[model samples]
Target: MLVPLPSPPPPASIRTQVEVPLALPDGSTTTARVVTFNGLVDGLEHLAFGLGRYAERHTAVGSSPATPVRLHSECLTGDVFGSQRCDCGAQLRESIVQLATEGGFLLYLRQEGRGIGLYAKLDTYVLQDVGLDTYEANVALGYAVDQRNYTVAAQMLLALGQPRVAMLTNNPDKVAQLRRLGIDVVTQVPTGLHVSDANVRYLAAKARHGDHTLDLAQLTGAGRARPRAAP
Candidate 1:
């Protein structure tokens, strides 16, 4: 269930903004401004990137609907070290390339391990190795399947002057949560990356229980199936 937060006192606010050169996968360089924010609740820092000259504008320009946005949570093992336990690193890289070309923002939230923290996530991994699925492992450990909340994400978007966006995600919960928090999600752009054998079942579990719109057969190359359309 998605619950709305009562526009709490800006959980996140920009601390500093700087322009930096971004290296693309095609060996080309693009300029983007990196905005760092301080979390009022957790006291942690979160980062967001504004691509192209639009960085100076802050909000989305033109009358062509909302701006493109990707709300990516922190995954140190998968994103930084490229762990195969999940497809996070691949999705992050894909989001970067897409955002760079399309001109949008990528909010890198500091909610590691779906908000369970790293140590507990590692324990869940051990439980997963013993035959439990990701959600089951979390439940067995007496935690919600997903402890992450999108309140901070919504506040960050509002702070960036982007109250609406064409969200880049496969999770319906994200759309619902954001909308509930007053962020209008105009459309959902799926991260249609294929899955590996190392995490096929993990992805399947998410699709089955997490309400993620994914075609496991297509992702795993088991068939030529299409993902379900967003609601």
Candidate 2:
């Protein structure tokens, strides 16, 4: 059975912030005002990276244009180890670049493996190797297809006084969930597709099972070679 989505959470408060210069994949550096929060509903140590003109946008909350934001879930393998099985790493990189240049917040949620945790994610990989798709593997292990909740994301936004936003993502769930949690998702901006030979099946599974906005023909068509796996 599916878990019920939590009601909109009470506004959280900013706990701390630090100026961190991040090095990107292309040898470019951008300064990020990384923020931590207090009173997030989940109580996980999720982070919010303020990039570009985030300070300016925060002050312009009630103005004509809404802030730009991306709710990125944690994926250790793809994000840290450069795994090619999914687009999480690519999306992270893309989000950093786009938000850094365009001004936004990257809400790094701590829902590893769709909220199942790191070990279960690895177990799912093993099940995938045996012909199970990502969702199937997750269910076979007695987990929901996806167990993430965006209540914390909304709280983070509200705490920052930026309730309205232009959400950047391909997953409709992110939009709907954020809206349900009381964030005004003014517009949905799709991320550029990062397809590769190794991620073809994984991306296809996301589209088929999760309704992520991904083009199947393009994924199945000619693509780049696989990225080198992490050591």
Candidate 3:
């Protein structure tokens, strides 16, 4: 049977441009100068899109048929404050270095707290502290387990006039979502870690229930193997 396709989401209505810089190897970073407003995209942010500037003078790198772009989600606790619970901070910084060297766009999506907002997400953390899994904690706070979406990134990529991309991700869902939405994903690059003591169970909950694709080898990290498989 042929299944009906999903309706395209509504376009975002608000936008603003801001510039940011990226740190390069050899100990320096290039500036974007002005943030290219991706206009407005939906799902993750109320008016979600992205902010980026040019690394090289050319917004779209020529010669390279498939441009490399890093779709980074905004993680307040980890990215900004250096929280050890997750690998977001490491992923973001590493991606910047790599992108700066290769000259690509870092589509920084402002999806804080896994789309649960800042305050409520903190409350979820409290619940997690009391032993509830990440998914359960989110449900307890009336939020979906993993609400981050990449459609906006796809649109932004299109707006940048690129035909295809080499995406950086560990979640298979990200790859599938981009492909299903008509974005060309030439390569899938893994970023960051699998689990930590601070986020071991949280990562397990994600891999099990949230349909995220992360392997245990990334998690076990040279420790005694668990008798069973990772969630």
Candidate 4:
């Protein structure tokens, strides 16, 4: 069952766009038409990047070869500072390359720390250091395990004329949430695992607790010791 938004969704429209060339750490470069939206239900400044022939491609609803899309939440530590405590930075980079090749959109959402805000996330890290898993740390701080909402994501997609999409994510909840919000997710694409000594436990916790589609075998076999089983 789905709970409706508090109010009817506000009409959304393209507010602006700019062509920006992106240079990745891997020495690859591609240009994206970055877009901003107006009239989003939540007034946050979420952005969408049009990649790989988005301007020339057919964007009709239910068009063949549904547009590839990745809804990326903001991660300051990983995305900006190159922190390896999580796989966020790697996933974002991979998404750009893949979306660019496939011709799609990347919705950069301003959801930090799973929607708990930056300060709270740092507090959770203290709990995590003392043996709490990610979700447990969030709960210990009196926050929901995950508080991300996709209504805004759906709204952005609808405004962009992409009623249907092929979602790039390992989290099934993202797919389910989008479907419930009137966005047709025709495909669910998984990202490669980014396992490291610093983030092995974090990845395992996501797979065990959040039901993220990650390979435990590969996680443990990535030349790193296996994290203890989740409680």
Candidate 5:
């Protein structure tokens, strides 16, 4: 029997909106609005950035297609401290730079360690050091390989008045989940591989098990590679 999916509840409204100056990597500056939203049910606060009047442009009559959007999950270690254990920091910076010119919104969700939380993520890293892959370590801890849920992301998009988006991501599951949650993902812009010796194996594990679209040879240069810093 076919059962209909229930509609998601109305997304919470923006709690605060403020404009601020943003410096781009290219030595240019632009004004962007930072909007904070609080989840109605979960109470998690998410940040949405309206880059260079992106909200105004998108809300204009006959605006072309959906806006370019990046749904980036928060990674405290990588994003804040520039840890090279994964490509999270690099991807976040890259997204900011690209969105500066492309004019889009970035939803920063607090889904650390793919929704397993920080403590478990650190424990998983220890297991990974002892010869377990990322997914295996999660299962060993009695959690799903990826505990992330995109319902909040979809709701945030709804709140931003962007029902569709050209998503920037390497994970196919993100696109699939957003669509299942009723957001129209018009296109996918791949966040290219940012490989480092500290994260090569980590990225490889994601590609193998997590269905991330990555070209290992291109990333690793076709050999057993030594660790290199992200460019």
Candidate 6:
């Protein structure tokens, strides 16, 4: 049985998609209110608490309900105010941009630092500095390497009438897990990483240990980064 996820406060509606101006370097931004679906169980408007509702958000944007969807875990530091520690912010930005063009839904699940939470994740950072890889860092902190659960994703997909998906990810585990849950995974939308000095180590660890299915050789074509080699 799935762990009973906590629900948001009684108000059925938790988001007000207000059009606020975002002060950007080049310009401002107009976006849907970013809600913590995992943080507040009932925060998502019309999203009834259910099996995969934790990390999934469904919206009926177009009159027709054939819009594609994206399943993204929570990366608080990156997804929220931009943080250069990882490529998460960039990937989140890219996903939003791409999804906007296609008119699809993005299920932003709250799996901060792959569900380890910021505080403990920071401790893991200390372990990383001491030569521990990302997974090892988590283990050092007495946590699973990847504490994320995709059952909520499956539940949300079914809820949004997206019983299928053309996933935007490089991780085969995500694809396999979703498939196992009976979500019709059409294909993968390889969202490449924007190589940066700060995130080089994080990205390298994914390829080396995290079992992510990104082709290192292909990444090299886009100018391979010399990340801090993990111990």
Tens-digit per-residue lDDT, 1-231, candidate 4: 134353325568989888898999989999888889898877999999999887333444557777889999999999998788888998898888888887899999999998888899889989999999999999999888998887788888888888889998999888988887778799898887887888888998999999999888788765353332322
Off by over 4 Å in 6: 1-67, 217-231
**Greater-lDDT candidate between 2 and 5:** 2
Per-residue lDDT tens digits for candidate 3, residues 139-223, read: 8987777677766766666656654888767677777777776777898866655345677766666678766666654565522
lDDT of 1: 0.78
Please, what are the lDDT tens digits per residue for candidate 6 over residues 31-142? 4433323333423322222111212344433333334556677777777777776777777666565565555557777667877778887788888887888888988777
Q: How good is model 4 by TM-score?
A: 0.91
What RMSD value applies to candidate 2?
4.4
lDDT of 1 at 145: 91
- Output candidate 6 Cα RMSD: 7.9
Query: Per-model C-alpha lDDT, please?
Result: 0.78, 0.83, 0.62, 0.84, 0.77, 0.59
- Measured against the true structure, the TM-scores of the candidates, in listed sequence, are 0.87, 0.91, 0.75, 0.91, 0.86, 0.70
| Arranged by TM-score, best first | 2, 4, 1, 5, 3, 6
Residue-wise lDDT of candidate 2 within 180-213, one digit each (tens)?
7778899998886777777788888988999988
lDDT score for candidate 5 against the true structure = 0.77
The numbered model that scores best in TM-score is: 2
In model 2, what lDDT does residue 160 have?
A: 80
Error of 5 at 166 (Å): 0.2
Q: How should the candidates be ordered by lDDT, best one leading?
A: 4, 2, 1, 5, 3, 6
Quote the lDDT for 26 in model 2.
76
Stretches of model 1 off by over 4 angstroms after superposition: 1-4, 7-12, 24-29, 57-63, 219-231
Clashing residue pairs in candidate 6, if any?
Answer: 8-42, 52-152, 55-109
Residue pairs clashing, model 4 = none
- How well is each residue in 162-220 modelled by candidate 1, as lDDT tens digits? 78799999898889888877888999989864477677777899899998988755656
Worst 10 residues of 3 by lDDT: 222-231
